[model samples]
Every structure is written in structure tokens, then in C-alpha cells.
Target: MADQRLERLIRQLQRHTVVGLDTAVFIYHFEAHPRYLPLTRVALSRIQQGHQQGVTSTITLMELTVRPCQLGRRAVAYHYEALLVNFPNLLLVEIDRSVARRGAQLRARFRVRPAEALQVAAALTHGASAFLTNDHGLARLNPIIDIIQLDD
Candidate 1:
């Protein structure tokens, strides 16, 4: 937790040329998680301002929309979908064959779920400096791309 302070994260965000978003980032933002929303919003604003590039896989949209769609909250689902699609300076990486192939390898090696593997693969494929997430487990995973744990 000491290592994951907000101030240090902001500096790291400034230093990294590119970072990837995981579905949790959107989930926190949309669900207004008290612990994570502030930093997530600030980082995203910085990205939108062109401070650094942000990228995520199309799988993110699928993940983000699930609960809302399941609850018949079409507006909320649409909101999530639209936000991911139109975020400024954010690149939505498609799950092409190359990404799928890489994800398959990641799945075999890391035992991560297919969607999670795809997300990591997409970030790596896009040359992101780090993959930003709140998943504490991923912090220890030693991915090819840096995994910045927002929750420490």
C-alpha cells in the first residue's frame, strides 16, 4: 500500500508514455467506487488531455456492459459502451487473430481466464508502458507489460 500511493501513481502516470486500462477502471468509474474513483478520474483526465496515451481491448466493453445489460439497464450499458468507444486519446484494441494467438499463449502460461488473457495480450500488443489495474493478484503475476496495481 505504501508503494501505491496516489501521488506516486500520478508521477508514474506522467513518466509512462502509454498505459492500458482494465475493465475494473471503467467499473470503478461507473459504479463510483469510493476508494478508486478519484485517482481513476484524474488519470483518465490526464490521458484525455494527451498527457499519455490510454488503450484497452474490446473485451473491456463486453466486461463493462455485462451487469448493466443483465439488469435491463440498457441506458447504463449504452453509456459504458459509448464511453469506451469515444474516450479521447484512448485506443480500443480489437481482438484480432494476433491478439487471440497471444492470449492463448498467456492463458496456457498464466492460467488466467481467456478474457483476462486477451486484455493483457491486447495491452502488450499495443506497446503500453504499463497495464493499470486494481487487481491485487496481477501485481504478483510479473507480466511482460508492467502491472500497476491501483489497490496495492
Candidate 2:
């Protein structure tokens, strides 16, 4: 029964056509955060179950690349690339003029930091209905978009 209920909830979440991923999600995926693994499984399971629209901005990808460079983990870098390449359900959003303009506007109006604005702009640009993040600042932007914060 518990498994059934969980599956039902996962299906409901997946029914939303678009979902956005924040940088921390990528970090968590790489670093093996205890709580993150299960959620990652849920997300992957959702995607495998036919949830087709998952997205993350180039910024998050860039950020994820940094840790390996900082740690001199070239192998990890390759692993990261492989993960992104193989993940059919995840889409990578690039930084562009429209994204910058919208991000600037969000910064001005919401007083969001530039990084957060870019993140939100990418999500919005991708037509995401939910932005999945572990950042607290996203809660403040909840008025601007749907934010799902992962507190792990």
C-alpha cells in the first residue's frame, strides 16, 4: 500500500509537463547526498516512466563542472558529461539574450541575485511549471513561479 501510494504521487508529479533543476541537484547527484539519492531515483523513475520534460540551465551545468576542476577530478568530469549525455529526459538550456533580459528584469523587480534570476529565467524559458531547488531564496520567488525545494 505504501509503495502504491508513492507510485501514485510520483505519477501525479510527473504529469506536470515541465520541471526545472537547480545546480544543487547536480551536485547532490555527484556527491551522493543521502537524501538526494532517493529523490534522484524518483525523478529518474518519473522520467523513465514517460515524464519527458526535465530541464536545467547552462549555468547549473557550468557550476557542476567547477567542482571536478577544483578537485582535479578529471574522471568525475567525464562521468558528469556521460550522465548528462545519457539522460534523455533532461534538457540543457543555454544562456541567451532573452534569458538575460528576463533575468535582469527578475533581478530588478524581485531583487533576486543574478545567478538566481538566470536560473529562474532558464526555467521559465523552458516553460517549466515547477523549479526544483534546494535554495531557500526560491521560496521568495514562489510568487513568480512554482518552486519545489529539496531540503537535503
Candidate 3:
């Protein structure tokens, strides 16, 4: 079960139909580290249950597969790729022209990396009311979209 603060955050996010996911969410859930795994897994399970729809940049596919691919664990990569593509309530957003342009703008304004900018831009482009990630640093972007940091 989630702690009080996390539970509150999840309840608040449930109010919105669509939420943006960062790559770390996928990594943490699939890899399952001791400290953060529980929260990340529960959060994803909630989305998978169709309670709140999840939207993520297609870049997530690349990010999720890199390690397993490097280690010749093709099956591991395939599992995550399939999950991202086939999940019913989840929408894997692509970095199209509009997203690229907006991502550049976001990059210029905030102290964010290109990947983070792209993820945030994808969420903004598609009208997601909240963005979820373990990166507490993204709280700086709250003015543009609600930043829901799972690790916080």
C-alpha cells in the first residue's frame, strides 16, 4: 500500500482522465528496485486498471529497451515494448513536429534536459492535465503542467 502523501497524490491525479508518464516510471516498474519499486508498480497498476489513462512519449520505448538490448536480453526489451504499445488505457505519444517545436521552447525556458523537455512537451501537446515521474526536479514546470513526483 502507498503511504499517506503518495495516496493523496494518487487520489488527486485520479481526478484527471489523462496523465503523462516519464521513462523512469517504466524502468522502475519493470526493474523493481527495493526502495522505489513498490510505489512505482502500484502507480502503474492503477493506470493499467483504467482508473486514469497514461500518456507517454514514444521515446519511452527507446529508453526502456536500451539496457536489455545491450545485454542481449531481447525478451526483456520485447516485454516492455509490448506493454507500452498494447496497454488499453495507455497512449504512447510520439514526438511529432508540434511536439518537437514545443519541446525546444520548453528546453530554452527551463533547466531541463532534452529528454525531459520532450516528455513534458508531449504531455502539453496532447492536453494531459498532470505529468507523473519520480524526478522531483520537474516541480519547476508546475506552471505548465501539474508535476506529480512519485518519489517526493
- For each candidate, the alpha-carbon lDDT, in order, equals 0.84, 0.77, 0.85
TM-score winner, 2 or 3: 3
Clashing residue pairs, backbone N/CA/C < 3 A, model 1: none
Candidate 2, position 41, lDDT = 65
Each candidate's TM vs. the true structure?
0.91, 0.85, 0.91
Q: How accurate is candidate 1 locally (lDDT)?
A: 0.84
Q: Candidate 1: where are CA atoms >4 Å away?
A: 1-4, 140-143
Residue pairs clashing, model 2: none
Expressed as tens digits, the lDDT of each residue in 20-105 for candidate 2 is 77888778867878766566667656665667578888787678888798999988878887786677788888899999999998
Q: Pick the candidate with the highest lDDT.
A: 3
Which residue pairs clash in candidate 3? Answer: none
Distance from true location, Cα of 143 in model 3, Å: 0.5
lDDT, model 2, position 72: 95
Q: Tell me model 2's lDDT, rounded to 2 decimals.
A: 0.77
lDDT of 3 at 57: 88
Off by over 4 Å in 2: 1-12
* Cα error of candidate 2 at position 76, Å: 1.4
lDDT of 1 by residue, 1-152 (tens): 54357787797787788898999988898888888888788788888999989989999998898998899999998988889889998999999999999999888887887887888888888878788887765664465767887775
